[model samples]
Target: MTDQISDAQFTARTLSEALPYIQRYAGKTIVVKYGGHAMVDERLSAIFARDVVLLKTLGINVVIVHGGGPQIGKLLDRLGIVSEFKGGLRVTDEATMEVVEMVLSGPINKSIVRAINQAGGKAVGLSGSDGNLIQAEKAQKTERDPDSHIEQVLDLGFVGEPSAVDTSVLDALLKSNSQLIPVVAPVGVGKDGHRYNVNADTSAGALAAALGASRLFLLTDVAGVLDKNKNLMREIAVDAIPDLIADGTAAGGMIPKLETAAQSVKHGVGAAVILDGRAPHALLMELFTEHGAGTLIS
Candidate 1:
């Protein structure tokens, strides 16, 4: 009985500490890029859904943009479609694009929406092609030959980057009488009437910028950005991002994520955080505590 009473008191104290943060974020919008190991882990995904509901209950509007690279690859392999990657992005052909859309816009998007709904929150699933939410252009890349130092353009068929984002559908849903959390899949339609596979991090940054979100949270697999010694960097200024990339502190998938976070902050987001999504209730720890859970960029 005494231990129970102590636990109750602790809970009360924690709530009291969170009151100020709750007030600060009330009525503001936040964009979350959900992906990585968190999507595959059942227990963590449940915690994430409940945490999102708790944020909405506190009057903070939340938007989710999710990725499904592993799922897409798995389906493509099963169907005997050859997969290729150039510069860390999938070289999507017409056949690959179909599978990407089917996985991202169909099952994965609905699963996330269902999770949130089951957690007692209203969630609506959407694709970037729906309502023309994301306008995209074919992405291009160049690589320099080590021996000749000559740059050659590589063609990554249907992969695209956002040119513009139309938020009318999202705005209507958020402003409706029945509040609904929007879960977006990152398959965009190009101006040439082609379907393009968009990187989830880039899509989330664009949406956050268009919506003037207060915070952009990227749920990643790591413990946030690290320095040369592999120590966590708690806070990074937007200007320092370029140097981090040039100095080799950031590489691989982390490059695009850091770039997206920097761009989102520059475009009017209050801040952006990249933290470990595998950690249970990471969102709550970052938002409500004095010491945040990830590396913050502003």
Candidate 2:
């Protein structure tokens, strides 16, 4: 009986802690970049779907941008195609582009949409090509080995960087229905009349910037950014980003993620958070609890 009473008290405290955040972000837009382990795990996926629904129910506008790297890789293997990456960007040729489109738009997007719907959220799945929502340009070839005196250009074919975003479609959807949530697959159409694969984090950052979102959340597998001691850093200012990158703390795949976060903050997004998607109720904890569970970049 005492244990049951404690549990009830804990639940009440949790709800009380969340009240401020719910009030603060009501009617504000939050762009969530959903990827990493959470996307593949059925349990985490359901939790994520429910979290999005809860946010919507509390009057927050939620936009999800998702990745399909593992799925794409599996498809490529099945098709007997070899895949490579240049500067962490997939070297997407014509054949690979076809598979990317199929995987991202067909199964992954629909699955997320279904999950959200099941959780009582009205979700519409879309690609960047839908309604010309995201306009992208081919990423220019970069010099591969500058130190080796090799001015060779490496072309990551069909890999695009978002050049512009038309938020009119999103606005229309939001205005037409208050409960509408957009689940975007990071596949865009290029000016060259070709389908291009955009990085999900990059797409989310650009969308946040375009919409002037109040918050941008990057849900990854890890426990957010760490210092030299591997301790999670709670907050980072935009000015310190260069130092972090220079000291090798933010290298490899984390570089792009941090860069996107900094860029979003610089471009007028209120704040960007890197949260562990594997944590149960991580979204709620990060958004509502006093001692949040991730790194906040502003």
Candidate 3:
């Protein structure tokens, strides 16, 4: 019938469209910063796992960095702990640090690892503390009084930034024929023997720089960067980010994402993308199709 014929034609076109992308990305390393809506939706979660497995099967190395903000918030609420944020950074005191570790490392990281395994890929769950992978220092807090002063030092109990990253451990994992996919949680320790919660995006950016990855993909809830007309802008130069931020088009969390993308490009990574994670097979569509779905910040 006519309906059956339409379905067949669509299937053929879809497969043809995907062929070039599979060929292009095969054998290259892709670092996927996996979070946002895709992680919360069960069907989307399975699809994401399948996409990673397929990439591995085709010989593309995948490194996954995940965020657990929602999960941490949920747990904090359950425990009757109130969270405070300064400049969008969670002010992590001692008690909050405990919950951060428990949620990020225990349930969330392991769940992703399990999904990848169930989807038939080899996955390893790692924290920044593992193999001394991420060495961090206590992030210096800023005091905003009448005069913004760095002299007023407030301790954001366990918020740390990556001062150093050793890629040797990651290299060894990738070299094995097992096609190991690393699922990393951003929790690092400082020289002063304190645990700190690093922003997952920052951690992933640093990892991409350290590993010199071919692509760094940040999966979020939006459909890439929009122009004044609200149309998705496919390609954007790194220098334009400042204007976008200043013009109020790129505000809120997108600012940090743009900052990370700029840092990645500056440090020798090929490209960084901010793609909508809600779209099914969004990863494959972005990587393989000529018209990608998210903002490609080069």
- Top of the candidates by lDDT: 1
Q: What is the C-alpha lDDT profile of model 2 across 24-134, one tens digit per residue?
A: 998889999999999999999999999999999888899999998999998899999999888566799999999999999999999999999999999999999997778
Which stretches of candidate 3 lie above 4 Å from their native place? 1-13, 141-143, 146-154
Which pairs clash inside model 1?
none
Clashing pairs in 3: 21-288, 158-196
Tens digits of per-residue lDDT, candidate 3, 82-189, equal 988875578999999999999999999999999999999989999988877778998887766556544556667789999988777788888847589999999887
TM-score of 2: 0.96
The alpha-carbon deviation from the true structure for residue 177 of candidate 2, after best TM-score superposition, in angstroms, is 5.4
Ten residues in sequence with the least summed lDDT for candidate 2: 169-178
Reference-based TM-score of each model: 0.98, 0.96, 0.92
How far out, in Å, is residue 60 in model 3?
0.5
* Superposed Cα deviation of residue 81, candidate 1 (Å): 0.2
Predictions in order: lDDT: 0.94, 0.91, 0.89
Residue 174 error for model 1, in Å?
A: 0.8
Candidate 2 — what's its lDDT? 0.91
- Candidate 1 residue runs with Cα over 4 Å from true position: none
